[model samples]
Target: MPKLARTIRFDESDAQVFSRPAEAGEWAIPGGFEFSNWTEGDLSGKARQAFANGWLSLESFGRATLVAVAQVEEAELEPLARRLADHFVQLYGAPDAEAALPIAREEIAYMVELCADHSPNVLLAVSRELTEAGVRESFRAITPAEAEIDLVAIHGSAD
Candidate 1:
């Protein structure tokens, strides 16, 4: 597996209002891939609007970058991430990670939408790589508990 850094930026205003300060070693799942080495800040603002609804105003509130493992070569991750990010912007607008305190499970559905709308081709490519690595069957056989552990390890949360 190759360790890939996926970079995602949100308007600093959105970051301030919506996102938590990423812990030093936190993982960010901006789209489908997991990113570590997260760097977040209240940087600056630029106008960003949803392609679909256009109701949400988005801007560059903060920026984050994290490392993740990918089955593909490291070189491929960036382009793949770019495609996914574009897809996310098109499908559900940019991420607004803000949620009320005591965050409810259902409140973060936007994140799920982001992940799901990320490039299907990238997902298929990753799947092919996993199958080639001989872990596809094992992944398929994972118990719910094991799956939870895996998700937490990669995403830093089970929620």
Candidate 2:
């Protein structure tokens, strides 16, 4: 089994704050690549909210304010990697799927590492800031009591 991050939503705020809100329970990653070229001015409004603390969902290319650690079966890995590779080709303009596959797998592997130390249902949030080097990201875990996430029901799948 592999552990990975899944999008979680508590209210409509995520929908309102993000240009495109990630669907609850979809596989997600820190996804700093989305803001790699952004300048200070671009980091305002909803976009800034996203840059400040959003996990990028692979399914919709949308943002989520929080993510929960979840266990994924080994069988799911290949398809997830392929889907991310396709995203690289379509969204990030990778030359081709063949060229993107390795990077996709690496990203997914990193997500697995991120979730490995946490138990299932452990909520995580990100904070980001752009520096001269590029986008820098930090993560913090929120307990269920602190987030009141037990009140929210997360559904769907990585699919």
Candidate 3:
């Protein structure tokens, strides 16, 4: 099984900060293509927040601040690739999906490789910026603490 990144949200801030916040649990990719034509002036307000730390959601085509590593079935790849290709044609103005398919596959593959070494449930965040050379991106991994319950967990008892 290949590992993949999925969006995760701990609070409402993602909704407040991003122009379009990705739904929780949506599949994600680095999505640097969105910023390929951007310059420093484009980095302002929510756009700046997105550039600083956002992963692109595959389903909503929205932005996420963090993603969790998850296992992916091999069968899911082709459909996802097709969806990405369609998105390229529709949004990025690719001549056609056939012409965009290869690039979509490569982008998905890159995200799969990025998650492969990390265990499931590990969180990943990305930071991006444009410099004189070009767009630059960096990533960081955060491992969840080893605990059976989180701070907001609930308990139930029955008689």
Query: What are the TM-scores, per candidate, against the unseen true structure?
Result: 0.21, 0.89, 0.90
**Highest lDDT among the candidates is held by which one?**
3
- What lDDT tens digits, residue by residue, belong to model 3 across residues 9-123? 8767789999999999999999998899988889999999988888999999999998999999999988888999999999999999999999999999999999999999998
Compared with the true structure, the alpha-carbon lDDT of candidate 2 equals 0.89
Q: Is candidate 1 or candidate 2 better by lDDT?
A: 2
lDDT of each prediction vs. the true structure? 0.27, 0.89, 0.90
Task: Give the per-residue Cα lDDT of candidate 2 at 137.
Answer: 92
**How high a TM-score does candidate 2 get?**
0.89
Error of 2 at 11 (Å): 0.9
Best-to-worst TM-score order: 3, 2, 1
Worst 10 residues of 3 by lDDT: 146-155
Candidate that would win on TM-score: 3
Q: Where's the lowest-lDDT run of ten residues in candidate 2?
A: 147-156
Off by over 4 Å in 3: 146-159
Tens digits of per-residue lDDT for model 1 on 1-159? 333222222223324433333322222233221111112221223211111001111122122322122233545444444544543455445563232211222222333333343321121111111223232211012223433443324333456
Candidate scoring better on TM-score of 2 and 3: 3
